[model samples]
Each structure stands twice: as structure tokens, then as C-alpha cells.
Target: MRKTITRIMIPVVLACVFLAGCGTLAPNYTRSAPPVPVSWPEGPAYPATALPAASPVLSEMAWRDFFSDEKLKALIGLALENNRDLRVAALNIERARAQYRIQRAELFPSVGASGEGSVSRLSESLSPAGKGETIDQYGVGVGLSSYELDFFGRVRSLKGRALEEFFATEEARRSAQITLVSEVARGYLVLAADRERLALARQTLTSHQATHDLTRRRFDVGVASALEVRQAQTSVDSTRVDIARYTGLVAEDENALSFLAGTSLRAELLPDAPVNSVTLLDEIPAGVPSEVLQRRPDILAAEHRLKGANANIGAARAAFFPRIALTASAGFASDDLLDLFGSGTGTWAFAPRIDIPIFTAGSLRARLKTSKIDREISLARYEGAIQSAFREVADALAQRGTVNDQLTAQQSLVEAAADSYRLSEARFSKGIDSFLNVLDSQRSLYGAQQNLISIRLFRLNNLVTLYRVLGGGAV
Candidate 1:
């Protein structure tokens, strides 16, 4: 028993010691240079931004601080807790971690204990003693069957690949969270803007309704013409149509917000103020392209996947060499049941195997080629992710640089339209100008008010999108 134990234990101990300290054949990973310019583009559309040199990156900031509105923050918090896409992403991380552990286990031997018994009838002619006999054999042993010796680091490389994949999964969850927050913010803003539009529609409806009633009274007394009364009625009818449209739009916005929040939202959590009341950070600086590549979760996830592909290439390269394994067992052997554990019953075994690929019909080469191609593909994807991120930042910056100018111009247009409506009404009341001028001015004013609401909505949504593309996320 002692000799058998030594035979089995010595090699197992040595394999474990060597395998634990071994390194993989995978090529060292080095990130390629970014595919975009080092600095943001210079143009009229690109905003010139000034920020403190020590200003934190968006990813490092807590999301609560990024948004100034309590209602939006509450809604975002609920979505983070209940979102299904995020739940799936979290589960994927767990699965990848388990897979990595399974791959890591390949670096060790699996030992097991077993007992066996065999009974056979020997024919007289076949027996060595030339007599019929019934034979019984019994043994108990500890054994390992075909345990691989990862001398070439193939197993370690596979483990490394699994680990990188796990990291990629984690980053993917982060990216999903960032996107969800942005979507929710934008949805809330849309709901708020729609509510404002509905309010404006109601105001116009009441104003035009009052004017239509006054004109009808005047026409009954033969003071206002029939055409003037019809014109007033037209304005009131058009506003009623707008009121219906905006009311429907408000309901749809709430529905979209509910979906984004992952549950039915309480009335208290819904937008109750105009979009202009919600505030975000000042337009962020487009510091450089590196900020996006280093901070964005989607880009980071792509980078991890690229590193994993590189690890896969190392494993594929290791497969071309011979595979070495060990099969060993130690036990007691006896034919007589009474002498099964008697003296001199100890037994041992050891088998070392080497499988050199003599011929594989090019399967090995094909796998190697496939792995290399996968690496190239991962590289392209990583770079593509970087490019996409840069473009998003650029697009957001373009709007950031010019949004204020557009808002100012729209405001001026509203003031002018409002003044024209007031003067045209006064002229119609004084019997100087036709009532058509009053109708035209009222329509212009309503259109300008609606457009102002749209511009405010655009500004708020752009801010949220900027935060997302810049890697600002709380969860």
C-alpha cells in the first residue's frame, strides 16, 4: 500500500506544482492606437468649451449629481432596480464567471476512489492448470484516468480567455445601465414637453372661444359681418384640434416612460413641470477622443473581448503540439476473498501518454487560421466601437455649440408673433383692418409657441444624450 501510494502521489504532487506556476503561450496584449484624431474637430459647429483642468470624467461622477430634478432622479432609480435588460446582463456576468472557474479547473488533476469485483468461469482447455474453474477478483483503489499535463499552457490560455470574457460581460452590464438611464431621462422630458403643449393648446382654445362668442354676439346685433364671425370660429376650431393632438401625444409619452422605467410609474414620479425646469450640467467639453475610448462602457467591453480573442489565438497555437497525459491508480489485489487485505496484496500502476499529431487532414491548421481570423475580427470591432463613440460625442458637441443660438432666435420669433397678434386684434376691434389679419396673426403665434416647446425639448434630450455618450452613469 505504501509503495502504491508513493507511485500515485509523487507524480500528482509534481504535476500540480508545475501546472500552478505555468504561464500561457498567448501573445502579450497591446491595444492598438485609436482610429480617430487625438483632438476634437475644429469647425463652426464644434463648440469651444472651457472647463477646469481637474474636472472629473463623466463616468467618475455619481448620476444623482448630474441631474438636478428630483422627479427624474426617482424615475431613473426605479428603472435601475426593475429593468429587465439589466437583469439579463447581470445574469450573463454570473454565467461567464462560472465558465471561467470551470476552465480554470482544467489545470489540476481529478482524483477519485473506487472498488471493483469481477467473476468469471474459465473453460478446462483455456485454463492454465487444464481444469475447469470459477474465479473471483476484487480490488479497492484510488485512481485518475487520462489526466492531462498542460506542459504547453493550452489549458491556462483557455482559462485566460474565459476570464476576459467574464470581464467583457461585466462591462456590457454597465453599458446597458448607462443607456437605460439616458432613455428614461429623454422619455421623461418628452412627457414634460407634451404636457406644456397641452397647456398651451388649452389656453389658445379658451382665448379663441371667447373671441368667437363675442363675434357671434356682434353678428346677432348686426355690428360684426358674417365673414368675421366665421373667421373667429375657424381659429377656435383649429385650437380644439391641436388640443386633441397634444392630449394624445401626452398619453403616448407617459406610456413610453412607463416602458422605460420597467414598471407603471406613480403620478408623483411623472413629469409635472415644463421641460425648461429640468436642469443638467453645462455643455461638457469635448476634451479629446481618448476620453470616450477610455471611459465608455461599450468601448471597454469591446476591448476586453479583443483581449479574449488574443488569448484564444494563444490556445489555438498550443494545440499543434503533442498532448501529454497520465493515467495512474494504486490498490490491493487478491483472488481469495479471505486474503483480499492480507500481506503482500498491495498493487500500483502508472501510465504516461504522449499523443503527437501524426496527421489531422489540416484540421489543426484550420483551427489556427480560424483563431487568427477571430482576433482580426475582434480588433476591427474594437476600433469600430471607438469610431462610433467618437462620432456620438462629435454630434452632441455640434448641437451643444449651436443650441443656444437657435433657442434665442426662436424666442425672438415668439415675441414678434405675440406682438403682431396683439396689434392685429386691436385693429380688428377698431374697425381698421380686416379680421383675416387677426386670424393670420393668431395662427402664427400658436405655431411659434409650439415650436418653442419643441426647442426646449430638444435641448433637454441633447443634454441627456451627451451625458450618456460621455460615460456618465450611476448604476
Candidate 2:
């Protein structure tokens, strides 16, 4: 009996050794495509002239430090804590973590306990006895039934995919965070620009009103004509119209800011102050272009997804091979519950199973092909993301130069218009020019001023866009 048992055990052990030597049950999948070139034509080259010398490349500066306004900081903090989108992102992270845990646990065995009882009565006619009899039986058992040994590394590969997925989800959450910060900052900037415009409109209205009153007095004294008074009235009315328009714009921007901050009540409570005026840094610190792959959350997420796709291809190919499973159980069972734990009632078992796939109606090959195709799709997407990122950064860099030039030109125009308006007003007071000339100058000046404000706002907004394109927020 001992020799017979040895013979069976030896063959089983040798089979396990042979299977182990078969290496990974999964096929090795060569990457369908080469890695995307990190250096694209649109990528920022070293020593870019557009980069400002003093502009610090956006780092993971706490939003509070970057914003600096106490109120804005408080608002951002509140949003981070309460934003619905952020909350959803956080929950997704938790879900991914749970999935990873589940996958990791599959590498371990499962244990269980069970108990059962039954009573039956049989007819005496079926037995040697001529009377009916009842028998009661009870049994209890604690055992580990089946546990797969990952000799072929299938479980390990699954765990690796799960880990990658977890990291990818984290990257997604970070991307959400970066977007949230940029959106809030941009909205706040819009509110500030609108407020500035509204203030300018009101100031213009007051000046026009004074001019109108002066013209009316002159006309009553026979020094100014009806035409002069009418022109002054027109200027005042137009300025009032501008004031109304800007007032509406301010209200709308405020509402937008409130929505972005995630609290309507807090938005209403914002301080009435212009956006903090800060000089644009002459130079911006731009790290190496390759660093973008590491710093940008979306890029990182894409890379992880690609990795997952590669792993899935391996898993798919593995399905065509044989699967091995080992199972063992040790327990106590007896007809009498009182004897369940007795030496005679002890029982145990061990089993090793191998399932070889001989045929599957072409399904296995089809699945493997599908997985390969999906990996190729993921590779393409990854390359596309890199190209898109490069283009965005390059576009932002190109815009910086153009926006700065526009701002400078607009400033000169505003100054020239102011000078022209002053001269026209003096000439009209001396009766050397018609009121129409004064009105024209005033209109030109107002338009120029408004344009300058818009340019300034655009420059600031472009700066925000540049930062975002460079993957500045949330690290």
C-alpha cells in the first residue's frame, strides 16, 4: 500500500514540476506598436524664448498659496471639501481600491464550516423487522474545499492589472482636481474683469453727465447751440447704456463664479474687490518637456490604461492553455453529533485537477485576436493623447507672444484716445469745434478703454490656459 501511494504521489509531483517548467501559462505579447516619441514638433524645445524669466512654472503649490486672497482661498478650500464632482472622483478611487483588494485576495485559500441534521422513518415491510423504525443522524464539518495555486502566474498577472487600474483611477481623480482649480480660477478672473469694466462704465457715465449739464447751461446763456446740447446728451445716454450693459455682465460673471465654487450662498458672500493686480513675470520656468509625461495626471492615466490593455492580452492568450487547480479538505463527520470530533470520525481529502482545452469552436482564438486588437487600440489612444498634449502646450506658448503684443498695442491706443478726447473737449469749450467732434472723441476713448480691458483680461486668461496646458495644477 505504501509503495502504491508513493507511485501515485511521485507522478503527481512530477506533473506539477513539468507544468511549472512550462513557464507562464500566458503567451508573451510583443507590444503591437513602438512607444510614442516623447519629442514632437509641438513640444517645447529647450531654451524657449516665449517662456518668462520670472514666471515660475506652475508646481503643486497649495491652491491657497497660489491664489493668496484669503477669501478665494477659503472658497477653494470649501469647494475641495464639498464639490460634487470631486466627491464622485473620490468614490471612484475607493471603488478601485476595493477591486484591487478583491483581486489580491484571490491568491489565497478559502476556508469554511458547515453543519447538517436529518431524521427519517422507513416502513418495516422494507426491512427484516415487521415494524416501522425511525433513525436520526447529525453531522458537522469544518474544511477548506478548493484553492487554486498560481503556478502559472495567472493570478499574479491579474493582481498586477488590478494595481495598475488603481493607479489609473488615482490619476483620474488628480486630473479632476486640476480641472476644478483651473475652472474656479478662470471664473474668478472673469468676475474681476467684469467688475473693472463696470466701474469704468460708471466713471464714464458720471463724466458725461457733468459735460451734459455744462452744455445745457451754455446753451441757455446763448454760448452753445442746440446741436452742442444734443451731442452732450447723446454721450451721457450712451455711457449710461454702457454702465447698464457692464452691470449685467458683472452679475452674470458673479453667478458663474458661484456655481464653480460649489456653493450659491458662499458665492453671494464674495468680497467686492478687483482681481489682485500682479505684474506678469518676464520669464516662466518650464521644466523639461519629457517631465510632462510624469507630471500630467491625464497622461499618466493613459499610460496605465495602455499597460492594462497589454496585460489583458496576455490573460486572453492564457485561456487557450491548460488550467491547473489544487483542492484539499480536512473535516469531522459522524452519524452521531456527539462523535463528530472523535478519532474515527476524522476525514481528509486532496485533489489536483488539470483542464486542457482541446477545442473550443474557434472561440479561444477569436478572443485572443480581440484582445490583441484592443491592445493596438489602446496604443493608438496613448499616442494620440501625447500628441494632443504637445499641441496644447505649443499653442499656448505661441499665444503668449501674440497676446503680449496685443496688450502693448492696445495700451498705446488707449493713451492716444485719451489725449484726443482731452483736446476735443477743450476745443468744444472754446467754440472752435462742433459738439459732434467731442462726441466722436469720447466714443473713441470709451471704445479704446474697453478694448484695453478686454486685452488685459485675455492676457490673464491665456496665462491660466498656459499653466493648465503644462499640467501645472495638482502635480
Candidate 3:
């Protein structure tokens, strides 16, 4: 009899394995392509310089290759290692991976081993033979208990949800990393620009101070009026105030950079001067907006979440179907522990269960509806992410085209202002012009120089922004 049972069970178990390969009931997953221009907008909004025919793949370029500054490269490395947000993002990926594994495990049966011993005393009144008796039983077994038969793909759907979530988290981590790199570079550029501005302020203050002293001496000799001296003093005092303001700004910039770095940064790693030149691989073939936006980590993460939502809909739908579960065991049993594994002491049991939903007061229907709604919500979010990314890239490109022209025009303005200031100063000293003319030229030159520095910083920082928006960092 035992041999006959074993033969029957072998095929049953094998059948279960073979039939478990049924296809999932989940809705087919199809990516919704974002609606965007085939290429970056041409014409005035996009500068001609911003459009490249073909260039190195932006996503594959290493951050090191994109940022040529040694100090900036070191700062970005430090931030990637120590930033708390990035660490959290990375840890989330691991957690999601573990969750995915746990859900996937539900698709398979878990077999385990067990050993048991039991003793019972029976009273005379309750004994079948009308005599008191003590009985002992020992058993060893291997079995699978209450394992679901996923004929409707419920488990598969859940596993798919877990998988998509895992992918989403991984992409989120990548997004965090890209943002961190951009932030570090921006902070460093601000610090450099502030330093240069601070230097310019000090130089202006010194020149104005000398002019004020010379005017005071000329006034004492009755060769210059008190008005001229006061004008010179006003310029000196205003420049002194600018110097103090810039000093504070430079300090604040350093603090911001350190916070992003996740640790106290060495002075050597800080930019000593304002960023006059930014070395970056700014030229990239602005492929169709869809192609570029698809590579963005945030956009990818959103799409994964959308996929997960679709999987959840499958799980909810499967809930409306019947569920089947199986429990089985084969073991050795005997009244004495010594005989538990002896010949002819074998035992076996099989149980199968089915649960068909009779009534749920509309719970199943409501759940299915909720899952579908969630999927729609995810779809909207995915589309929104693509739109946001498209806008960012467009804005960056718009700035990229005109920045060089702005820089060039600013340099020319500065040169013209400097010449005007020099001529006015000479004329005032020679008694051919009022001190007011010198003051006006001085103001103009000072403003022009400040504007020049600002434009230069913008150009450098814009390159960083463009790189980030294009998803150019990290291979």
C-alpha cells in the first residue's frame, strides 16, 4: 500500500511543478511614451550654439571627465560618499531588493523538516478496552504546509509589483546622486565668484580711499573744494560696505558647500578664486526630447512606479478568483522512538483546500477599482515627471546659447567703463572737469566690473546646470 501511495504522490508533485508555469493574469505592461518635440526647440528660445549635431553620449560620460577642476571633482566624490540623503537613497534600494526577494519567494513552496514526540495517558473509563493505558508516539517528517497554488497569478502579480518598486528605488538613488553632483558644483562656483567679488571690492575701496586723502590735502591747501572731498569719501565708504557684504557672502558659500560635502572640507579643496573658466563637456547632441528625458533618473523612477501600480491591479483582480492551497507530509512514525524509522513504520497525509468567494459585500470590486485608480494616478505622475524634465532641459539650453554673448558684451563694457573712469579722473585733476564727472565714471566702472564678474560666474554655473539637466554625470 505504501509503495502504491508513493507512486501516486510522485506524479502529483511533479504535476504541481509543471502546471505552476501558467501565465500571469496581470495586465500587459506597456510604456507610455511622453509627448515631446523630436528635437530641442529651434529658433530664438534655443540658441544655435546650444544645438550640437552629434556628440558623446551624455548619460555614459563620467563625472570626472565632465568636471575638469581637481577641487570640484574631489568635492563631488566627498558628497557622493557622505551625503545623508544619498546614503538614505542607497539604503532604500537594498531594502526594496530584500522586499522583492521576500515577495518572489511566495511563488514557490517552502519545504521543511520536523521531528515530534507525544505521550498521553488514558483513564480506564475512557479507554476503548476498559483499561488504563499510556501511549507514546515518535515521528520524523518532511512536508510542505498550506502552499498556495497560484493558478490565477496572484503571487506572480505581487512579485511583479515588488520587482518594479525595487527598480524605482534604484533609479531614485541615481537621481539623488545626480542632484548631489550638480549641487556641489554650483556651491563651489558660488564660492569662487564671491571670492573674486570680495577682492574687487577691496581694490575699489583702496583706490577710493587714496583719492579721498588726496582731495582732503588739496582742500586744506585751498586747491580743492570740500564737495570734492566728500564725494571721494562717499565712494570710499560705499566700497567699504560692499567689501563687508561680500566677505559675509563668501563665508556663507563655504558653509553651504561643507554641508553638501557631508563632512568638514579641507581648505585646499575649496576654490581659491572665482571660477573664471569652467571645464565641462557641454556639447551633446540634444536628441529628441523623448530620448533625453527617458534617461533621466527621476523620469525612470516614475515609470517604474507606474509599472508597479499596474502589477497591483493584477493582484487585486486575482483576489476575485478562487484560491487553492495544498498541504502534504510523508514521514516515519512508531510507538517507540527506536522504531520510528524502522521498516513498515511509514505514514503519509495529503490535504487540499479551495476558497471561492461567496460574498464580500462588494469588497473585492472596490479593491479592484482602487487598484485601477492607483494605476491611473501613477500614469499621471509619470507623465508629469517627463514634462518637468523637459522644461528643465529647455531652460538650461536657453541660457546656454546666450551666456557666451552676454559674457563677451560684459567684458567690452568693462573695458569701456575703465577708460572712461581714467579720462574723467585726469580731467578732474587738471581742473578741466568737476569732481562729479570723476565720481560718475568711478561708479560706472565699478558697476561694470561687478557685472562682468557676475556674468562670468553665470556662464560657469550654467554649464553645470546644463550638464545636470542633460543627465551627463555617472556612467
Q: Judged by TM-score, which candidate is best?
A: 3
TM-score of 2: 0.85
The segments of candidate 1 whose C-alpha lies over 4 angstroms from its true place after superposition are 1-22, 116-138, 283-285, 333-342
Candidate 2 stretches with Cα past 4 Å from truth are 1-61, 123-131, 215-234, 264-271, 276-283, 473-475
* lDDT accuracy of residue 252 in candidate 1: 93
Candidate 3: list runs displaced more than 4 Å: 1-22, 49-54, 118-135
- Over 208-292, each residue of candidate 1 has an lDDT whose tens digit, in order, gives 9988998899899998899989889989998999889989998999998888778998999988888898887764654567866
lDDT of 2 by residue, 191-255 (tens): 77788888888888988898899989988999888988988888888888878888898788777
Candidate 3 global lDDT: 0.87
lDDT of residue 328 for candidate 3: 99
Give residue 59's error in model 2 in angstroms.
3.9
Error (Å) of candidate 2 at residue 148 is: 2.9
